[model samples]
Structure formats: structure tokens, C-alpha cells
Target: MTTARRIPVAIVGGFLGSGKTSLLRRVLTGAADTAVIVNEFGEVGLDHQLLRACEERVELLGGGCACCTRRADLVRTLRDLLDDRDRGRAELRRVVIETSGLADPAPIAFTITSDPMVRHHFEVERLIVTVDACNGPAQLAAHPEVAKQALLADELVITKVDLVEPEARDRLAAQLSELNPAATIRTAVHGVLEHEALRASAGRAEPGARPDGRAPPPPARAGAGGHTDDVRTLCMDLDRPIDWLGFAVWLSMLLHARGEEVLRVKGLLELEDGTLVSVNGVQHVMHTPEHLPRAAIADPRPGIVFITRGLDVHRLRDSLETFQRLARAGAGVSGR
Candidate 1:
């Protein structure tokens, strides 16, 4: 008989100096026998060696983020870990991947969720991101990749808050709220949080819990730009319901044309025909369109969040609406 699958496979990601390692150290100290995959960008993985106690089970795949140059290596390493558990050499309970600070979380996440073998043994419990409170704002202003990390996280953790002034803290919180209003923001000092709340999500919805706790409330209004330490995130909310077929067509074209730059697209769309679709995409690949089992009719306004590198929001909005309008016009004629 096959053993039951486990939960609590978390991804601890953040920009450089965002306290990712510090958080992992805390988790490992408490959760024993947990499997960890560490990816480092430097030639020498000194950080991996630093975690002395976890040496035996910890696997290091240093070189770059697994999604870019070392994707195959990542797949192979995970395969080996699965094999070990089957052979009874190690009893693995949970898995955590600490991504490089500059890495794009979407591709790494897509691999885990899309791969057949890995999906069977592991499920993505949640993505936890650490924000360097002192410098997060400046970083987002300069680096686009950092913005991607903030947007993709399920939970946003503000690290090194003690280092910054209270004024800076307020600004950082406001900026983070704008960038990833979707994720729950928690402050951490020396990397400590209540385990139940920190890891409460555990890759499963407890009884009627919704993922990410309902759709991110829409941005107050259309914004020109929002900046973090290194990148920017643009949010747009449609005042009226959207035409589903047209939205699909526009999304397909957008992905085909700018997939690499498009890190992630997640939104709740109200269809013209009265059904609702929760659509999410990572780079060029998109998850099969997921229809909500029930309608969120109370909130009919469609909301869209896009994480991209160096894309003009105004231009994108124009193109998307144009495609949507064309699609709807065609549908109207067909109905007659």
C-alpha cells in the first residue's frame, strides 16, 4: 500500500538580505526530518554548508535559480529524494525550497505544480516571501525581478524591521500593500513567528477555508506605478464584468507575444454568460482555466493583477481592452 502524501511543502523566497536563510534556520530547528532543497547563485554554496545540522538530508543545487539554467538538475534531485523515501533510507515528511534572491518564483512554482512525479509526492503548501524592510523600497525601484518575488508570494514577511526607522516601516508597508495586497503581511524580528499562523496554510484548505483568503480586494483606483526596492507591479480593476471569450483571446495573444516578460497573471473574471473563472498564468504556460464551483456574485467587478518586467501599464491596458471589445462585438452579432 502507498503511504499517504504529506503537506507543508513551502517555498521561502526573498531578495538578497531579506532574511530567507534566517527564517529557514528557524523552521528546521523545530521541524525535524524535513527535506530541504537549496539553490544558490554563487559558485561556492557556502550558505548550504553553514546549515551544519541539516547536512545529511539537505540537497544543494547551486549555480542559478532552478527555473532558468538548472531546471533539469532540480528535477533530477527531486527524483532522487523521492527514491530515497521509497527505499526506506530516509523518512521525509515535508519539503522546502529556498530560491535565490534574484530568481523568478513563478517558473520554479510552475515546475513543482506541473510536474507529474513531483506533484504526486508534494504539493505547494504556500510561498513565503521575506522583505528587507530597510531597503525593500529602494530595491523595487531599481530591480524588476524583486518585484516579481513580492507579487507571487502567498505570505509576505517583513524582515529586519528593527533596522529601519518607523517612518520607513510605514512607507514599506504601504508599498508592499500596493504590490502584493493579496498576501498576508507579517512582521518578523530575528525570524520568529507563531508556527501555527506561519505555516497554518499547510498546502491544504482546512474545512471551508479559501486559498489566499478570498480575492485580493481591488486596488483603490487605477494607479500609474507602484515601486518596491527593485521592481514595479501594476494593478487594474475592471468596473464592469468582462467578456470571457474575448478575455481568453486577449490573454492568449498577450502570453504568446510577451510571455518571458510576463511573470504571472492572476485574476477573478466575471463571464458574460454568468459563470466565473479564476485564471492564473506563469510566464507562457497557463494552468487550465479553473471555474469557480460557486459564483462570487457579490463582487462583480473583475480584478486583474500582472507581474511583469519593464512593461508599460497604460499600453497593456489599452491592448487588453481593445481585444476584449472586439471579442464582445463578435459575440453580440452571433447571438442575433
Candidate 2:
């Protein structure tokens, strides 16, 4: 039997006054088939009221942040949206969840993926995070949540660029890149970015895929830019095809042991079957791995990037290599 199509979900997250609602307002204008779930930390949800003018299907989760106290409400709201779509009461092609300013996006992702019913009906398409150009530097230095939000994003939108000087904006962009080397960075003035750029499907590309067909140079070593909280980005290149079973075991163990410290991981891996798989995870929760068509990728070298806190890159690399070697040796003996 064929599987049913799942609704794609886009998560919009950032710190207070980071222009998330403004960005969402622009993206949702004239979007008839999209439903929105807006979370606010107070008893009254003012953001949802502003958003209702742009889209018809808007649900509010008031009185708590979506990442923690209001998580169950989020799940209920999503299931309710699905019910509306199923009953023909709503025509929904996509769902957007606007997390509260102080929300942690990882738990919201985990809630969707971990719920058996919800996971079957919905898939997280992308994580879009906004950063204030004026206050982003201080926020990154002082608030661990803001750094986590930036690091976990698939696309980082630097908002209010006009408020800062050109040099300051450039510096903020560079810092975001250092925090998340794999994410695509864009700038917005007055929360306005090209509509196409804000689309859920626009930013993701195969790791190291370039216009010239040459892999881009590897990211700089961690700590080179002196990031705060010991949070650093690490990039690793795969020299050979990886054994899938071994790779799975290695990742499972790593996340199980040090999940909190490993904030995010993104990679494209070449497996022993000569197929390429894309891996993405936030904290301990991983999105389902995706298989890529061989014809589409230009650079065949497999690469992985990690945004981690207080973790040694060398030790992590060694652990992965050791597991792969052991798996290969076991396969050889079994073959004989």
C-alpha cells in the first residue's frame, strides 16, 4: 500500500524582539493553505491577533512557552489541525509553528517526532531562526538559549539589519556562521526577506555541493573565533564509504551518553551500498535519515558538521573511526 502524504511543518524561533512575528507576518500574507500555531508566554496572545489578518487558520497556545510547559498543548493543537484537514473543514498544505520568544526549538522538534501519531502525520520541514542585528552579539554572549537557537537553525535570518552599521552586520553574520557552519545565513531589513528565501524548502542543500562542482573548503577549526560557553562547530570529512550499522551504533551511543552537550549535527554520508544518506539531529532527537539520488550530488566526499558545547572534537572523531574499523573487521570474518 502507498503511504499518505505528511504535512510539512516549519518552526520559527528566536529571542525576544528578534523580529520573528514580523517575519512570519510577511511569509503568511496571502498564504491560504497554511495553518499557524502561535505560542505566547502571557495570558493573552497578542502575536496571534496580529497574525490572524494574514492567515485564517491560526491557533494560539497562550500562558506558556511551547518548548516546556505548553508542549502538550502544542501536540493537541497539531492533532486538531490534522483533524480539521481530514474532515474537509480546512484546506491545509503546510503548518507553521511560531514559538514564543524564549522557547527552545529542540524540544518542540522532539515532541513532534517522538509522538507516534503526530510523527506519522507531520514532518518538520525546516527550522528558521531570527537574530536581531543590534542585540545579537550580546544575546549570544549572555543567553545560552539564543546561541542554541542560532546553532540549531537550518536557516539563520538576521533581522533589523538597517539598524546596525554595515561592519556590525558583517560581524554578526560571521559569528552566526562560526556557530553553525552548515546553516544558510540571510539578512533582512524590517523583517522583510524575499518570500522565496523564507520558504521551508529553499535553504537545505547537500553538504559541500557548489556551483563549480568542487567541494567548498572545510570549516575553520573550532574556537578559532572564540565563541562563548565553549560552544564550537566541528566539520569532518569521510575518506571512505561508511558501514551503516556501525555508524548507527556509534551515533546512538554518542547521543545517549552526551546528548545535552551535542547541540546539533548535520551530515551527508556515503554508505557501503554506494548510496548517500543525509543525517540531521538536534540534541538527542534525530530526524529520519533521507536517501539522496546519486545523480544530484556533485562532490562525492561525505562530510559531517557538529555544533557542540564543551566537547572535544578529536575524541569524538576518534570514537567514530574506531567503531567503523571494528564493524569492517567483523564483516570480513563473517564473510569467510
Candidate 3:
């Protein structure tokens, strides 16, 4: 008989004071079955203690950041969870790792995909980052780490909007848009975000995307962008499907030419052959692309989204458009 497969893992990351803890608390309380791994139990101990009565599977690594110092512990903990699932002792179906504010998500993601023992049992479902609406712009300007966190996210959540004025909220949202254009950002009140929307923003497969109740599509507007320090981000949309080989060549060239200046790039793209592909990049290094089974009636088109620091958007856009056009024209025509 075959053993039951372990579920996917979700990494929740953000800058300091970015409401990651609040969001975790809400998810822990609401989720039916889950296991959480945090740096220290005491860090968010109050909330953890409050939810202890939920009878959920919980594990805490008390010493260091899960991505760096405590990485071994993380591997061990996840292995144990898999063991339990195989033994029918625990009904653990998902895992969430709330990373430290200073953590870099790329290394953590790399570890998840590359670790032999953990890789077989679990896959990375999504990278979610929360931005504090009040301090987001200033943090982005003053800190490079803040930009890095936002760059790695599949979805960006703009938290604490009610703390500021209406106009300030709009400006904050705008800034988030400019810094990480590829991410899907939305406002939340306390921890009562539309779980389905947040999950959908991350992607269709990750936890929190499907709540028990019905949900509406998020407002059809581009996310807001904030200006911090000298760094900036630009977000754009492309309605056409991309040529797979051309896209590969174009991405490689772009990374070689301007990778150092790029912070992150994430998007859900449609290949010319009618398949959906999820792509993400941090600086010049990109993780392997994850392809989804094609939906019979869904449109296949490229949705270009980018997050760059100290790069020119107009020039970049022009270059991308030109390459896209050229790539389309040359595809399947043989070598030049």
C-alpha cells in the first residue's frame, strides 16, 4: 500500500511590524487542519496560546530564523509531520511558516524545492508578503530588505489601511503597486480579510483561496504603489499570449542585462499553446517555472508584471514590447 502524500507549504513573510502575526493568528483560528512553524513560540506566544485550544497540530522552533540558522530544525519538523500523516496519527493537511522580518524568501524557497527529503513530501504553494499601509512607503525607501521581501511574494497584502486617512491609504496602495507590480495587493481590516480573495491572490491551489462560502472577484483596478527612498517599482499588464521559446530567450537576456537592478518579478502567464505558467524571480535568479494543467475554455495570454528598484519603467516596457513582438515573429521559423 502507498503512503498518503504530505501537503504543500505556505511561507508568510513581511517587514517588521507588518501584521504577519495578526494574519497568522487569524488563519490558525480559522483553518480546519494546519501546522505552524515559527522562529520562536514566544514571539507570537500570546496569540498561539489563545489558539492552543483549537486542537490543531503546532510546532515552534525556539532559537533562530527558519530559513537560516534553524533550517535543520525545520527539515526535521516537517519530516515528523509527514511521518505522522503516514501513521494516521495526525490529519495535518497543510503547513505555514511565518518568517522573520529580516528573512530573504529566495533562499527559503530554494531550500524547499531542492531539499531531497522534504521535496518529495511537500511543495511550495505560495509566497505571501504583507505591507503595512502606514509605514510601507517609508520602509521601502529606507530599507533594502523591505523591497526584497515584496519582490519575492506571489501576492502582496496591504494591511492597516484604517489607521490612516482615506487619501493616505490611496497613496500607500499606489506606492505598493510601483514597488511590486506583479503582486496582487488588497486592504484588510484587522485580520478579517476575505480569506478566499487573499488565497486566490496567491493562486488557486494554496491555502486560504477557497473559503467555505461564496466570494466575489476583487475590484478590477491595478494595485497602488508607494515611493520610498530612491527605489521604485512599475507594474504593467499584457493581454497577449507569449511564445514559450521566445519568452525563455527574452527572460534570459533581461536577467543577464539588468538582473542586479531587479528586485522581483511574478506573474501568471498564458503560453501561446494555451497553458498557464507561474513565474517568479528574485534579482537575477529565477526558480523553475511551475505549469498548471490547461483549462479547456480559458484564454491563454501573457500577463507581464515586474518589480524593479532604480530601473527605468518606460525604457524597460519598450524593450519588453519590442522583444515580445520579435519573439512572436521568429517563433517556429528555424534558426536565423
Candidate 4:
């Protein structure tokens, strides 16, 4: 029997009035093979209504926010999407999870990776975030959620650029870069982005390409330019394998304790057993770590890049190192 192809999930998120709906509309304008699962906080899902394709299976999640309180609902909806596809109810080329304006991409993404039922069926293909040029700067400055949205983005599309002045646009672009140096930034008009840009933004990796969910770690960078002026990005390179169990426990605990401030965590860790592990998270939701091919794998340099709010990277690195050491010592005891 042929193995079923796993569907890719593209998560679209942004702050309130950030043009998320408009950009989603553009993606579905002519793509008949695509399907969507939209989480609308209101009783009525206007985004689903706007999608005119009769064949497109658009599931609307309303009442509470999908990324937080209603996150379990999202997992159920995704399973349903896969079931429908398996039963020939829908033919889809791609699936997009359009989050509510107030949503964070983390929890939903965590649901996708963390759940057993849908984990193998769906891989997070991309996280696209829209920033309204007119209000993006102010939103980034005044709202922590806005920064979180941007920090979690794989592609940051600045919409309504025509409404803002050139200088303002540049400033916003720079700020976004500071927030997520790894994300590709683009300007959009009327929520329309270039097809090439969209394709690039998705990274469009084949199933095995990014098995670990680690996008190329952003270059080593350190800055405090965004609002709160506390979001610190720390990048590191490690040449040794680590103790996976201990590191996982420690990192998980760290997120539990300081999830609000630990915006984005991307790391490529080498295990003591000579395996390469990719570990990353957004806020409190850690993506399931993946083990890569061990024999002469490409891009073997283990890198950790973080975009955080008031996190002490030095302390974090030291703690991680300590955990790995203890884990190794325990493992040796077990072997004896």
C-alpha cells in the first residue's frame, strides 16, 4: 500500500486589523485546490463567507480564541479536515490555518506538532503574519501580542503600505527585522503579495526537507529596538552533542515559568548519542523536537537563535549546559 502524503499547514496570524483576512482572501482568490480552517473569534465567520469557492473546505472556529482557550477545538478541526480528505470529501493541495487577529501562532502550531492523532498527518509548512503599515508601528509599540505575532512569523508581510509614508514604511521594516531577523519581509498593496514571494515565504520544503521544523537559524544577532525594548535575540553555535532528556525538561520548565516573555526559540542541538536534534518553540508551545540524519548531514552547525522579552541568554545557555551535564552523568549511572 502506498503511504498517504502528509498535508502541510500554513498558519496565518497577525494583530487586530493587520490585514490577515485580506491576505487569506488573496491566497484563496483563484487557488481551487487549497483548503482553509479559519478561527474567527466572533459568532459569525466573515472570512469563511468571503471565500467563494464551493469546493474549498473552510472550517470556522468561533466563540473563543483558537490559539488559547479554544486550542483543543483546532486539533479536532484538523483531524476532521484529514478525515474528510481521506473520504474523498475534499481535494486539497494546501491547508491554511487563518488565526484570529488576536491569536498567536504558537499554541496552534504546538497543537499540530504535539497531538498524536494529527502529528503525522500534518506538518507546519509556514507561518505567515501580516502587519498593517498604517497601524503596525503603533501596534508593535503598544501591544505585546503584535510583537509576538511578528516574532513567530516565517514571512512578515506589511500590508496597506500605500497608506503609510515611505519613511514610516522603512522604519516599520527595520523594526520587523529587529523583531525577527529570520523572517522574510515584503510590502503588500490591498493585501496582494507576489506569488513568488508567497512561495518563497512558505519555504515550500518537501516532506523530508524540514522534518525538524527548524528554519535556517537567523544569523547571530543582538538588539533591543522594538517596543518594551526588552526583546533580546541571542544566537549561538555549538560544536558538541547534548543530553536531550535533561535539556527538554529544563527548556519545558523554562517555558512554563516564563512563557509570556520567551517569544521565539529556535535551536539545532547535537545529542550525545551522535544524533542531531532540532528544537524550537514560540511562547509556551514547544514544537516536537526532531532527529535528523546522523551521517554527514548537510548544515551540521548546531545553532540556537532566540527572540525573547527580557530573557537573560547567558543564564539560559549556562542552565542548558548544566542540564546536559547532569543528564550525561545520570545516563552513565543508568548504563552501569
Candidate 5:
């Protein structure tokens, strides 16, 4: 028997008062065949109540439902949602998990990816983060979670743009890009972005699923121009394949040494064994590398995008090359 197709889980995460609920409301009002799982219903009673108000606005969900729960019961709640959908009580094509303001999205991501039951039925589609433009700079400087949320995002949405001055908005945008250069960034007024941009921003189309992002390496330039002046971006284009094991070690060391400074790493890598690996990481957490499942892709070209702070690209590239050589030599010696 064929296994049933798994549904995708898209996450909406951000720091407190970052207009998370506003974005969640937009998500509810925008789509159909979507189920929503909201956590920490009582922590900020006002926001939960405000978001719950969306139920009345989403009259066209077509029998899909949104349930609110605390953090601890998320896995169980997900199972319940699946069960309900299976029972014909509702129809769900995708799931959207709106985390509480103070919650760390990585753990939720871990729960979805690590739990055997959850992973079998569900796969993470993408992580969309909302950042409040007016207060983002202060938040990033004061709260580490704010940076984590920005770093892990597939798309970062800047909310309440109208409330902030143009300079502040531009600075915040630069900081976000420096933190997650690979992420698609869009600005919104009251959480509404253009439909096309929003759809693209709510990614998880399978990494490398889009044929358009491939590009020539960018010109090496100035570092991240944030208020803090710590973040930076590096884009690399490769013509040759790489040894997977060596690359893994290089990445492990990079994160192990400066995970806090390395905000995000994302790209397509061609492994020497002829497998194409898609990598995405934030701080110390990494999603398992995805090998293409569609078919044999002939293009073995490699490209990598890094978002980091306090590290230069040239050094990173040199160290990686050295490790690859060392690893190959070690393998040869062992074979003898």
C-alpha cells in the first residue's frame, strides 16, 4: 500500500508585540483548506483573545478549524488535528502553527521533525517570521530570541512599517537581511503584503524547489549595516562538487565555535558521492540535509549563502577548503 501524502506545516513566529497576532489573523483570513494551531492561549490573554477574534472573520475556511493550546501539549494537539481531519469533521490541506510571543520556534520545529508520528504525517513547509519595524532594533539588541526568530525564517515580514520612520525601517530591513540574507524579505502595513509576495514568502516549496534563485556570486561588499553593526552576508557560487563529510565537519565546527554569530546558512551543495544536499541552519540547530527525491538532477554546481556576524567570508572559505583536503587525505590513509 502506498503511504498517504503528508501535509505541510508552516510556522508564524516572532518576539512579543512584534505584530505576530496581526499576521496570524491575515493568514487565517487569506486561505482555505488550512488548519491553525495556536499555542500559549493564556499568557497574554489580550493577544489570544484578539487573535481568537479572527474566527469570526474567517467564515470561508470551508470547515477547517483553528485550536489554541499551551506549549506542552503541542504534539498531542497536532495529533488531534490530524485525527479530526481524518474523521471528516474538517478538511485540511496544510497546517499553520502560530507560536506564542515568548516561545522559541526551534523547539516546535524540532518536535515536528523529530517525533516519528508527527514526521510521518507532517513535514515542515516553511517558517515565516514577523518583525515589528518600529521596535525591532531594540528587540534584537536586548532579546536573543528575536534574533533567533529572524535567523531561522524562510521569509521575514516587516510589520507596521507605517508606524516607523523611513530611516528606522530601512535600517531594520538591512539588519534582517544581514541576519538571513537567503530569506525573502517583504514589508507590510498592518500585516498585509502583496498576495504574490506573501505566497512566495510562505515558502517550503522544497529547498531548491524554485528554479529561479540560482545566480552568479554577488560582489563582496560591506558588512551588515544594522544599528548593532554585527551581522553580515556572504554568497558563494561553486563550479565543482564537494565531499559531504568534510563539509559537515566544517559546518559543525563553524556552528560549534560561533553559533551565536552565525545567524543563518542556506544553499545547495553538490556532494562528491553525487548527491545534491540542501542545507538550512540557524544558530546551533540544523534541519536534516535534504537529498533530492524527485529525480536525478544533472547540474552538480554548488552555491552557498551565509549570514554571519564577526566572521569574514574569505577565511571561512579557506578553512573549508583545507578541511576538505585533510578529510580526503585521512580517508586515503585509512583505505591503505
Candidate 6:
């Protein structure tokens, strides 16, 4: 039996009136072999109408959010899309899901990675979230869902920058960086972004590193302006190589215990075997680790950034250290 090709999926998410549709319209312009799935929370869906001009295969899930009431529909839609491709009914090289403004993208990601049939044929490429520059700060502070959306995104696009003053835009960008230090932040005017801005590779520059391969200044700590939630960013830099087995155990236990609190975790680590591995996860769902070339990462030291809610960073660090020590001791016993 021939193995089926897996399709790449990108998720576009943000809060209400955050310009998700505008960004989707920009993304689909002149792009071929791409299928779009739009989820709107109201009974009367309208975003699909705006997107139809650019895409031929537009699937709409109306009256429900993709992360909650309509998740099953999402899975069914994805399966049908795959079936169509196999039957030569649609030319689908990529799939983009434009989630409702009020949707939390974590569940959508969890669904894609957890469903056996869907996981076999589809993989999440990246999550792109839009923030309304004029209202982002207030929205982020008032809405925990909005904060979660920003925290879990791989790429964050601040839209309507033209409406905000330069100082305001810069402040919002800085705040978002603190919320998600690992995410790549870009500004969009009138929902238009450079073609390359949305590409996965554009944000591949290692977090905390500048384009010139130098480490940038550290961002201010999270928890400013009375965020109303416990969300914060915790960064850890390890001087020694990680024991994969121990690190895995620590992470598994952490997520199993407090998956919802642990919003997002991402980092690069040098293993005891001298291999560099990139690790990323959203809530309880973890992506398969990818091996990387040392030259690709500007920093020699291994580091991880955790975006968590109501979790103590000190306790987390200690727990991980204890697990690593135990793992190394066990390895020594086995070798002896």
C-alpha cells in the first residue's frame, strides 16, 4: 500500500474584528492549490463571501466556533477534502483554516493532531493570529481567550497599524512579544502583508535572535498593565545537553497535570547525543521533534520559552532539573 501524502495546514485566529478575514483574503490572492475552511460563530456566516473571490474550494462552518461546537464538523470537512483530492475532485496542496474571531486555536490544533484519520493525512504547518492594533491592548487585557490566542500563535500580525499612533503600535508589539516571546510579530496595513511575511520560513529565525544572527535585547517581563490573568512567559537557558528521556518525562507530566495552564512551549535543545532538536507544543498536544543543523541557530546554548497561565516558573524549573538528574542516574546504572 502506498503511503498517502500529508497536507500542510495553517490556522488563522484572533479575537472579534481582528482582521482574520482580511488576512485570509490577502493570503489567498493568486495562491493556487490551496483550500480554505472558514468558521464563523454566527448563524449567518459572511467571511466566506469575502474569501470566495480568491478561492474556489471554500468550506464554511456557520453558527459555531471551530474550537468548540463545530470541531467535529471541522474533522469531517478535512476528511472530505482529503477524499476529494484522492478522487481527483480537488487540487489541494495546502489547507488554511480561518477560525472565528472568538475561537481558541488550541482545540483546533489538538483536534488535528489527535484524530487518528485526520492526523494521518494532515499536519499543522503554523498558526497565524491577527491583532487589531487599535484595540489589541484592551482586548488582550479583558479577554483571556484573546490572550490565549496570542500566546499560542507561531506568527502574530498586528493589523490596522495605520489607525494607531507609531508609539501605540510599538507598545502593542512589545506587549505581544512579552506575551509570546517566541512568536514572530509583524505589522499589516489595511490587511495587506508582504507575500513573504506569512510564509513559515519568514519566522524561522530563532526566537530572541536578530536577522543578523545576533541576540536581541531581552523583552520586558510579562504581567504588566494588570492583565487580569496569570499568563506569563518563562524563559530558560541550559548550559548542558539535555537527556531526551528525562526531558520528555518532565514535559509529559507537566502537560498531563496542567495542560490548560501550560499554554505553549517551544525551544531548541542539544541532546546528549550531540543532536539539536526543536520542540514545540500547544497545551497537551506535542509536535514531533525536528532535527536541526547547528548552524541554523545563532545561539550555542539551549533555551526554551514557556507561555503559561498561573504556573510558577521556579517550580517548573526545579521539577525539570530533578527529572533530568534522575534520568541521567538511570542511564548510568544501565550502562554499568
Which prediction has the highest TM-score against the true structure? Answer: 2
User: Which scores greater on lDDT, model 1 or model 5?
Assistant: 5
Per-model CA lDDT versus the true structure = 0.62, 0.73, 0.63, 0.67, 0.65, 0.72
lDDT (C-alpha) at residue 281 in model 5:
70
- lDDT string, candidate 4, 169-276, tens digits: 888877777667646677888777743332221111222254232344434343323455666776655656777788779888887777766777766677777787
Q: Give TM-scores for every candidate, taking all chains together and pairing residue i with residue i.
A: 0.68, 0.84, 0.70, 0.72, 0.70, 0.83
Q: Count clashes in each candidate, considering only residues at least 3 apart in sequence or on different chains.
A: 12, 0, 15, 0, 1, 0
- In the predicted model 5, the residue pairs found to clash are 125-204
lDDT of 3 by residue, 1-336 (tens): 998554777888988888888888777885646877777766654353212211112232223222222255567677777787678866677888877787776655655665678877777777888888788877876776777677667667778877988788777766555445455566666765643333223222333332111121222322233433435444444467777777788788887777666666666666777667777666555756867665522443345456565677778778877888888777645554
* Residue range 1-336, candidate 1, lDDT tens digits: 978754346777888888887777776775655777775334113343212121112222323333322245556667777777789867677777777778766655656666678666666666788888888877776776777677676677888878888688767766666666545567777877522232221111222233322344533322214543223444666656788767877888887676666665666666766666666555665655656644434434456677665677668888888887887788889989
Off by over 4 Å in 2: 41-70, 194-227
| Cα lDDT, model 4, residue 7 | 76
Write down the TM-score for model 2. 0.84
RMSD to truth, every model: 6.9, 5.7, 7.4, 6.1, 8.5, 5.7
Model 4, TM vs. native: 0.72
Candidate 4 off by > 4 Å: 1-5, 40-68, 113-115, 162-167, 192-227, 272-275, 292-300, 327-336
Q: Rank the candidates by TM-score, best first.
A: 2, 6, 4, 5, 3, 1
lDDT of 6 by residue, 1-336 (tens): 988668888988888788877777677776667887765334223333222212212232323332222256678778777788789876888888887777777767877887788888888878889999989999988877788788888888999988989899888887877778777788888678633333222113432242212222342256535653566667776667899988988899898778767888877777998888878788877877877777765555567777787888778878888998999999999999
* lDDT measured at residue 19 in model 5 versus the true structure, 0 to 100: 78
Q: After superposition, how far is residue 93 of candidate 5 from its true place, in Å?
A: 2.0
- Cα lDDT of candidate 4 equals 0.67
